[model samples]
Target: MTGAKSDHVAAYIGLGSNLDGPRAHVTRALHELAALPLTYLAEHSSLYASAPVGPQDQPDFINAVACVFTRLSPLALLDQLQALEQRHRRVRQRHWGPRTLDLDLLLYANLEWQTPRLTLPHPAMRERAFVLIPLAEFAPQVTIAGKTSATLAKHHDGADLHRLLP
Candidate 1:
């Protein structure tokens, strides 16, 4: 006999924070992310310290990527992530400025999509070592935008990553 179908779909979420207790923000965000409807936090990599990428002169960011299993649609998942950000009082006053928390949907079960409000495979995940490293650690064989995490990290060279042990 076949088992009952699970209402679970795998996804990747990128977590980052650089202000108001960066480490605490990341930890809290993970808990909040798991609390979303039809979702479970499957795994997470240890945080990493990454140099700011845009608009130099910002605090170094604490970053990690989470693996989640969820039945929520991509848009719905995005909505929940935004709500978690708001709960932490995340602000968007400056581009890449410090914030309490930030959550980004990095990939959604190999589904390729782009909309005015969101994009899967994150559009820029391949070039960022911070994202690629944690992702490679958790799901090395997973493909994103037609490339494996290993390939993405190989192309990246991991120049500005410093692992943050928790």
Candidate 2:
């Protein structure tokens, strides 16, 4: 981050994978996130195992959440994230297909944004147990739209999730 420390924005990133040794991909990604330029990883949640949200044929996914303080604009951070995904050999053969890594910008400093390429407070994050369970670990009070993470997470049955590591 550059300029005043006030310039830094707290961003939440969700991580998941089901291919190429899922646990290792997620574990390595946690370290890689800390390496983002002008960015610092404030905290990260433990790994979790969950059923895939889309196709049922693929293996289960390993999921986690992270909070980062960064100077990069939302899109810039997104670009960096996509690049990291590519480094992991992510292939987009189909929607929600199995991949080596998946990184999502779940929230960006409580800002709501939209563009052809991306959206702040990711569209589906509110409903994903994989995303919420881990997010609650570091940011239970975080509010998106009119709901807080803790409140939103409260209603989920959590039967779809299994904590894997701390």
Candidate 3:
């Protein structure tokens, strides 16, 4: 499905926040993602709570994934996502550290691409339950690295991940 029509392509973005009212941050980011130019917020997973992936002293994170239909090129999409992060005052104090907002371009119409700036199928998606489980909720049948989203999600432990009330 990498050869979708030129007008639009379906892409997935992973959203997460751990600083400054994370749930509100994620909710606002969802609205902003929908408002992006040439993009439609197709669907999203419920908010999920998970322990921090890096430093232990930080607060838990709120996470979710979104699927969108977009006419923008992959790099352009990346630029928009980065701009969104910056708008939320995202910081890079340390790798996997807490943030106000984090957006990851997980997939783009099944295309496999690599640049100094981005990677398709997200290099760490398969191994992260936070990404796979939420991704499977909207796109269970999608395949990545030879396994479907449902399959990957089903196999992950996700012991630290829990869905939040709507």
Candidate 4:
């Protein structure tokens, strides 16, 4: 999907990786996101190390959040994210299983909608410290469901999240 001509919107994307040189996968994905046509990366959170949310047998994840300004509609942006993931050899064999890269659309200008292909505000973001902690770094004041990222992050006090880089 595409947006109105030249109408840029701010979007946040959640990134995580636990396989295939995880840190390099994330770093390279950031560059790919910034290079997407009609989009510019606005900000990015520091890299983080977090316990895997599912299937604990896998490696821990390196995660972060990135903010971008883009003319693409939510779905189009999602397509771009998936393409980048494919470029990094992401495979969808198991739910929340380890992967070379995972890119998620966390928010798009506060617009909330759902389709078979995507969901706004990421349905599970609020409950996951992996998403919230890094998101708070770049968007401390941004609210989801009336709660700031920082405030929401505090709710996940037991989540195993640690900053890995500035």
Reference-based TM-score of each model: 0.93, 0.95, 0.95, 0.93
Residue-level lDDT of model 3, residues 34-151, one tens digit each, is 9999998888999999998879989999999998889999999999999999999999999988899999999998899999999897999888899999989878988898889999
Question: For residues 78-97, what per-residue lDDT tens digits would candidate 2 score against the true structure?
Answer: 99999999999999999988
Candidate 2, superposed: residue stretches over 4 Å from native: 1-4
Model 1 Cα RMSD, 1 decimal? 2.8
Count clashing residue pairs per candidate: 0, 1, 0, 0
Instruction: Give candidate 3's whole-model lDDT.
Output: 0.92
Each model's C-alpha lDDT? 0.85, 0.90, 0.92, 0.88
What RMSD, rounded to one decimal, does every model reach? 2.8, 2.4, 2.3, 3.4
Looking at model 3, report the run of 10 residues with the lowest lDDT sum.
1-10
Is candidate 3 or 4 superior in lDDT?
3
Candidate 3's displacement at residue 28, Å, is 0.5
- lDDT over C-alpha atoms for residue 86 of model 4: 91
How many clashing residue pairs are found in candidate 3? 0
Ranking by lDDT: 3, 2, 4, 1
Summarize candidate 4's per-residue lDDT along 16-121 as a digit string, tens digits. 9999789999988888899998898888889988899878999999998998899988999998899889989889999989999999999999899999999898
- Against the correct fold, how does model 2 do in TM-score? 0.95
Top candidate when judged by lDDT against the true structure: 3
Residue runs of model 1 more than 4 Å from their true location after superposition: 1-5
